[model samples]
Target chain A: MQQNDYTYAVARIRFKETKLLSDADLDALLSAKDTDAVMRLLHDKGWGDGTSHTSDELFSMEEEKLWSFVSECIDDLSVLDFLRVPNDYHNLKVAIKCITRDIEPNGLFLSDSVSDAEAVYEAIKNRDYNALPEYLRDAAKEAMTTLLQTSDGQLCDIIVDKACMEHVYRLGKESENDIIRLYCELFVASADIKIAVRCAKTKKKIGFIRRAMASCDSLDIDKLSSAAAEGYDAILSYLASTDYRSAIDAINTSMSAFEKWCDDDMTAVLKPQKWEPFGIGPIVAYIIARQNEIKAVRMILAGKVSDISENTIKERLRSMYV
Target chain B: MSEILNNSGLFLALLGAAFATFMAGIGSAIGVGKAGVAAAGVLSEQPDLFGKVLIFQLLPATQGIYGLLVGFLILSNVGLLGGVEEVSLLKGSLYFAASLPIAFAGFYSAIHQSKCSVAGIGTVVKKPDQMGKALILPAMVETYAILALLISILAVNGINGIQV
Candidate 1:
C-alpha cells in the first residue's frame, strides 16, 4: 500500500501517543515507596483493564491491550512481521527444547507470536517440520537434529537464533518502509554485538563466534567474531570504529548497562516519529515505545519487590517516547 | 477547413469549462477524502475534536468551488447558458485561454493542500490547543488557488471587451 494509506492509522497513533507514559511518569513511578504504590499510580494512569491485579497480571494485560489496539488500527498485521518474528522463533526454541527433553512446555511460550506456540510444540513433538512456516522449517529441523545427535542445547540455540536474525534482517530489507528497515538493522546489529560481547567474555573459539553472529549492514561480523576470539578490549576497540562508537562506554559499564543503551538508542532513533504525520513510522514507533514502557514497568516492579536501590533501578529505566 | 476552424473555437472554449470544473473538482475530492480519513481516525479516538477536524477537512474543498465559479463565468460569457447563439473564433479562443489558470492551478493546489491538511490533523490530534497554528499551515496552500481564481475571473471578464 501507498504511504498515504496509513493516514488514518498515523493520526490515531498521534492521539494515542499523548497517553504514553512520559519521562516524568517514569520518575513518579521511581519515587513510589513500593510495588503497591507503583501499581496504584499505574492504576490511576489507566495502565491495566481496571480489575484489581498483580504486577505481572497488569503487565501482561497491558501487552495484550497493545497488540489488540494495533490489530484494530491496521488491516494486515503482517506488516508487523519484524516485531512478531522474534516471538515465533522464541516459540520454536521452546518447542524444540521441550520436545527433546520430554518435558511439557506449559507457560514457556509467548502469547503474541505470529504462530501459535502450542501448535509449534505439537508439530515439533510429532516431527512434522512441514507444519512450521517455510522460514522456520529448516531451522527447526536442523536445530532438533543437532540437539538429538550431539545433545548440545547451546548449538541448537545458536542455530535458531542465527536463523531468526537472518529472517528479521531479510524481512526488513524487503520492506519498503524506512522505519522497518532501520529497526531490522538495529535489531540484528545489536543482537550480533551482544553475542560478540558474550562470546568474548566466555573465551569462545573463533569458529563458534562466527557461527553464532548474524550478518548486518552496520557491523562487520568477521571483524566482530575475530574480536570476540581476541578479548573484550578488542571488541571495544573494534566497535570504536563503527557507528556504535558511543556504545563502548555502556559495554564497559556492565551487560545490563549495554542492554539499556540498546533500548535507549532505539528510543532516540524513533523519537522523531512523533512529529511524523504519515506512513507506518509512527505506528511502528508507538508499538516499540509501548513495549519499552512495559519493560521499564516490569523492571521497576521487580526492583521494588526485591527492595533494590532506587538509584540502581533508575539507572536501568528506559526513556519513554512521549 | 474554415467550418472546422469556426466550430473548433467553441469546442475549445467548452473543453476549457469542462477542464476547469472537472480537474479542480477531482483534486478537491481527493484532498477532502484524504483529510476526512485522518479526521475520522482522530474522531475514533477522541470524538470531541470533531469540530476542529471538520474545519481542516473543508480547507481543500474551496479550490473546487473556485473552479466552479470560473467555469460558470466562462459558460455565461460565451453564451452557453443563454443570450448570444454563437461566439467568434477569437473570443472563443480567448475564453479557453482564460480558463487555463484555474483549470491547472486548482487541480494541483488542492491536492497539495490536502497533504498539508492531513499533517495538520495529526498536529491537532496531539495538541488540541495548537489548532490555530495547525490550520494556518494548510491555509497557506490556498493562496495559490486564490491567485489562480483571481487571474481566471479577470481574464474571462476581459475577454468580452475585445473587438474580435
Candidate 2:
C-alpha cells in the first residue's frame, strides 16, 4: 500500500493469488492416479486452454499466460530483465553452437526472453554481433570467435555464462528494489556454485574454473574457485564456512537434490512476499511462484508419464509459495 | 495596515472555513482515488465482490464530509450564508485557530486510513470471508480523525460564544 505506484497491479495480483497452488493442492496432484488423472486435476484447477493438448503444450500455454498476465500488470518489462537475461545468454550459446555446426536451432531456445531467439540466431548467422544489445555484443562476439577458433563448445558456454552472471550482478547492484537485488544475488551465486561444482567434477584447471566464476557479494570467487579446483570436498568445505552451510546435506545427496535445495531455499525466502499487499516484491514473488507451479506440475506429469516412482518426483518438486 | 486588519474579521473567518474545507477535501480526494483504483482492480477480477470493495472505496469519503460539516458551521456562525456579521478580528482569529486541529488532522488521517483500506482490500481479495477482520484495520484509523473532529467542533462552538 505504501508503494502507490503498484497499487492497481498488486491488487490484481492479490486476486490472482487465491488461485495459486497450495501445499495441499500439490499433495492432491501428487496423489493423482495417472498422467491423465494429473492432467484432469490441472484442468479442474482452470489451467490450460480447453483442448486435448499434450502435457508440454499445457505447460507452455501456462507460461505464455503468466507472461501475458505480468505484462499487463507492469508498465516496463525491463524491471524484470534479471529473470529474462539468462535466456538471452542461453540463446546466444545455442546460436553460436548451431551456427558453427550449421544446424537449425529447433526447440533449443527459450521464448519471452530479453533478446529474440530468432534475431540472435540471425545475428550470429550473419556475423553481426552489433545487432544485439550492447551488453551482449561483446559476449556474442567473443563466444563466436572462441568457438570458431578452438571448436570448444564448453568454452563458449563459460564465456556466455560468465557474461550473464556479470550482467545480473550489475543489475542487482543497480536495482532499487530489494527483491530484485536478492533474486539477482541468489541467481549469480547459485550459478557460480553450480559451475564450480561441474568444472571440479570434470577436473577443469583452476584458472578455467576461476574464469567461469562470477563475483557476488555473498560468495568469494577466490575461495570458491580454488575450492572447486581442489575437488567436491573442498567446495563443500568452503560452502560450509559460508552462508550456504545448510546446502551441505543436499550436496552430499546428489546434484539433483542440490538443485531442489536451491529452489526450495529461494522459495522459502520469497514466501513472506505472499502477505505483501503492494510493490514489486509481490509481483516478482508471483512470477517465481507461477514458474515454480509449472515446474512442479511438469515434474508430476513427467513422473506419471514415464512411470517413475512418485517419491522421485516429490523429491524434485520445490516448495509451493502459497 | 492596523486599521485594515482590524476590520478583516469576515476575511479571517472565511479563510478558516476555506482552509478546513479544501485541505481536508484534497486529502480525501487523493485517498479515495487511491482506494478506488485498488477497488477497480479487484472488481475487474471478482465482479461479485462489488458490495464489499465499495465500502473500502468510500471509506476516505467521510473526511470530506467532516470537512463540509466544519465549513458549513463556520460559514453559518459568521452569518456568511445569510446576513453580514460585524465580527472583531480577535474572534475571527480565534475561529481560524480553532479550525486548525481538524484542518491538519483530517488531511493526514484520511490519507493514512486509505492506505489501510487498500491493504484491507488485498486481505479480502485473498479471504473474502474475513471481511470483518479486514474492515477493522482501516476503521481503527478513523478513531484519530473522529477525535480531531470532536475537538474542532468543540473549539468552533466555544469560540462562537466568545464576545470579543
Candidate 3:
C-alpha cells in the first residue's frame, strides 16, 4: 500500500481509538442507576443515537445489540475473521451438547462466521460424518467415545476444548503474518498459562493438565507440562525464570495473579515492538493497545461497582504495554 | 574519458546526494512542522501533557537524519573526502540512481508519517499518556525510509571502478 493510504488508515484508527471509553467515561458508566443511565451515557458520546432514543431499546438485554454497535464502527472484517476460531469452538460445543441431550437446534446454533451453518447443523444432526472438517470429525468421535465409555459429559467438553486450543496454537505457529502470529501466540500462551495456574491452585491431578495442554508459541509446553507433573510450587519456579517472575510472589498459591501477569506481560512485550517498520505491527499494536485500554477500563469499573479500594484496583491493573 | 568521468561523475553523485538529502529533509521538516502545529493546538488544550505530545511531533524528523547519513556514506565512498576532484559519469549516475529511491521515498513517507502522528496527537487530546503508542505508528512508517537509506548506502559503496 502507498504511504498515503497507510496514513489514512491510521487516521481512521486514531479516531476510533479516541471514541473508546476513558477512565472518566467509565466513572460515569458505573455511577449510572440502571442500564437506562448507561444508554444515556453512551448516547452522550453519540453511541446508539439516531436509531434508539429510549434506554430500554438500547439496553443489550442479550449481548447482541452491544456487539452489533461495536461491529458497526469497527467494521474491519478481519476482526470477525480473527474471532471465528473461538466462536466456532463454542458453537461446536453447543452442537455436541444438543445432540447428546436430544435438544432442538433453534436457539443452539451460533451466529458466528460459519461458512455454511446449515451444513454443520445437518452433519451434526444426521450423524453423517463425511460432511464435517477432519478436526471436527475427530472431536465428535472423541466426544462420543468419551460419552459411551465414561458417561461423563464434562470429559467431552474438556476434550473438545483441548482440541480447539491445539488448533488455535497450530494456526498461530503457521500464520505467515507477524501480527496475526503474535496475536495467536499470546492468545494460546495465555490460555495455557491460565489452565496451568487453575490446575495448580485447584490441586487437580497432573492428568487433567496433560489432557488440556496444547503447545503455545510463547511458553515452553514441555517445561509447563513438566511443572504440572512436578506440582504447583514447581510451576511457579519455572514461571519465575521468564519475564513473568515479577508475578510469582503475587500469585503465591493463586491463579488470578498469574492470569493478570500474562495479560500485562503480553502487552508489555508487544507495545515496544510496535515501533518497528512495516508489515502490520502498527495495526496490531493499535488494536491490542485499544483492547488493553478497554480491559483496563472494565477492570476499573468492576472495582468501582464492588467498591474495592483504589490501591487494590491499581495493584490489580495490567501493564498498558507488554 | 576516465578524467571526464571522474569530474562529472563525482559532481553528479554529490549533487544527487545533496539534493536527495535536502529534499527528504524538507519533506520531513514540512511533516514535522504540520504535526508540531497540531500538537501545539492539542497541548494548548491540555497544558500538562505538552512534553508527551512534543516527542510525537519530533519523531517524524528522524527520516531527514537517515537521508543525510546515506548521503554522507555515499560521499565518503566516492573518495570525495580524500580531496579527489571528480570522475566517471557512469559511476556518478549509478550512485545517483541508487540513492534516489530512499531520498524520494524518505521525503514522501516522512510527510505522510507526520500526518499520522498529527492524527495520533488529536487522539491524545483527551488521552495524554497514549502519546507514546500514538507516535509509534509514524515511527513504523518512517522505518521504510531508514531501510531505504541503508540500502542506498550499501549500493553506492558496492559499485566499483568509478575512478576519482
Candidate 4:
C-alpha cells in the first residue's frame, strides 16, 4: 500500500502519543508512596475504563484498550504480525510444556496473539499440525516431537524460539515498510545477543549456543556463537565491532540493565517517527511506544509491590517515545 | 483539410478549458479528500478541534476554484459564452495555448499542497496552540498555484488583445 494510505492512522497516533507518560510522569509514579497511589495516579491519566481496578486488571485493560484502538484505526491487523508473533510463540511454548507436564494452560496465554492459544493447544493436543498457520506448522511439530522424544524442555524451547526468530525475520524481510524491517532486525539481533551472553555466562558449548541463536544480517550467528563459547569478554569485544557497541555498558552493568538498554535503544530508534506525518512508520512506532509505556508502568507497580527502592526502579525505566 | 483546420481550433480551445477545470478539480478532490480523512481521524479523538482541522481541509479546495476561474475566463474569451460567434483559427489556438499553464500546474500543486495540509493537520492534532505555524506550511504551497494562475490570466488577456 501507498504511504499516504496510513495518513489518518498516523494522525490519530500523533494525538495518542501525547498521552504517553513522559520521564517526569514515570518519576511521579516511581516516587508515589505505594501501589494504591500508583493506581490512583494512573487512573488520573485516563488508564482503565473509569472503574476501580487492581494493578494487574488495570494493566491488562490498558493493553486491551491499546489493541482495540489499533484495530479501529487499521483495517488489517495482520500488518501487525511483527508485534503479535512473539506472543504466539510464547503461547506455543506454554502449550507444549503444559501438554508434556499434564498441567492446565490457564492464565499462561497472552491476549492478542496472531493465533488463538487455545486453538494452538487443541491442535497440538490432537497432534494435527496442519490446523496451525503454515508458518508455525513445522515449528510446532518439531518442538512437540523434540519434547516428547527427548523429554528436554530446554531443547524444545530453543527450537521454538529459533523458529519464532526466523519467522519474525522473514516477515521483516518481506515487509516493504522500513520501520518494520528495522524492528525485526533489532528484535532478532537483540535476542541473539541475549542468548549469547547467557550461554557465555553459563559456559555452554559452541554447538548449543549456535543452535539457539538465529541469524540476521546485522549479526553473524557463527561469530556470535564462537564469541559466546569463548567468554563474556570475547562477547563484549565482538559486540564492540558491531552497531550495538553502545550496548556494552549496559551489558557490563547487569542483565536487567542490558534489558533496559535494549528497550531504550528501540525507543531511541522510534523517537524520530513521532515527527513523521504520513506512513506506517509512525503507527508502528506508536504501538511499540505504548507497549513500552505499559511495560514501564508494570515494572514500577511490581517494584512498589515488592518495596524495591525508587532509584532502582528509576534505573530500569525506559526512555519514553513522547 | 481546410474545413478540419477551421473547426479544430475551437475544439482545441474548448478542450483546453475542459482540461484546466477537470484536471484541477480532480486534483482538488483528491487533496481535499486526503485532508478530510486526516481531519476526521483527529476529530474522532478530540471533537473540539473541529474548527481548526476544518480550515486545514479547506486549504486544498482553493485550487479547484482557481481552475474554475481560468476555465470561465477561457470560455468568455473564446466567445463560447456571449460574444461574436466567429474567430480566426490562430486566435482559437492561442486561447488553447494560454490555458495550458493552469491546466498542468493546478493539477500537480493541489495534490502536493494537500500532502502538506495533511501533515499540518497532524501537527495541529498534537499541538493545538501551534496552528499558526502548521497552517503556514500548507499555505506556502499556494504560492505556486497562484503563480500559475497569474500566468494563465495574463496569457488569456494578452491573447484577447492580439489582432491575428
If you superpose only chain B onto the true chain B, what TM-score does each candidate give? Answer: 0.95, 0.96, 0.88, 0.95
lDDT, candidate 4, at B83:
71
Off by over 4 Å in 1: A1-4
Top-scoring candidate (DockQ): 1
Give a tens-digit lDDT track for model 3, residues A85-171: 666666777777777778866655556443345566678778876788675778767776787688788788778888778776676
Write the residue-wise lDDT of candidate 4 on A196-218 in tens digits.
99999999999999999999999
Candidate 3, after superposition: displacement of residue A211 in Å?
A: 2.4
Better of 2 and 4 by lDDT: 4
Candidate 2 lDDT by residue in tens digits, B1-164: 97777668878888888888888888799889998988988888899988999998788878877877888889889989999788789888888886777788889888988888989999999999999999999989888878878987898899888899
> Who is ahead in DockQ, 1 or 4?
1
Structural similarity of chain A in candidate 4, as TM-score:
0.97
TM-score of chain A of each: 0.97, 0.96, 0.73, 0.97
Predicted candidate 3, C-alpha RMSD: 9.8
DockQ for every model, please. Answer: 0.85, 0.82, 0.07, 0.83
Q: Once model 4 is optimally superposed onto the true structure by TM-score, how far is the C-alpha of residue A280 displaced, in angstroms?
A: 0.4
Candidates sorted by DockQ, descending order? 1, 4, 2, 3
Mark the 10 consecutive residues where model 3 chain A has the least summed lDDT. Answer: A1-10
Cα-based TM-score, every candidate: 0.97, 0.97, 0.58, 0.98
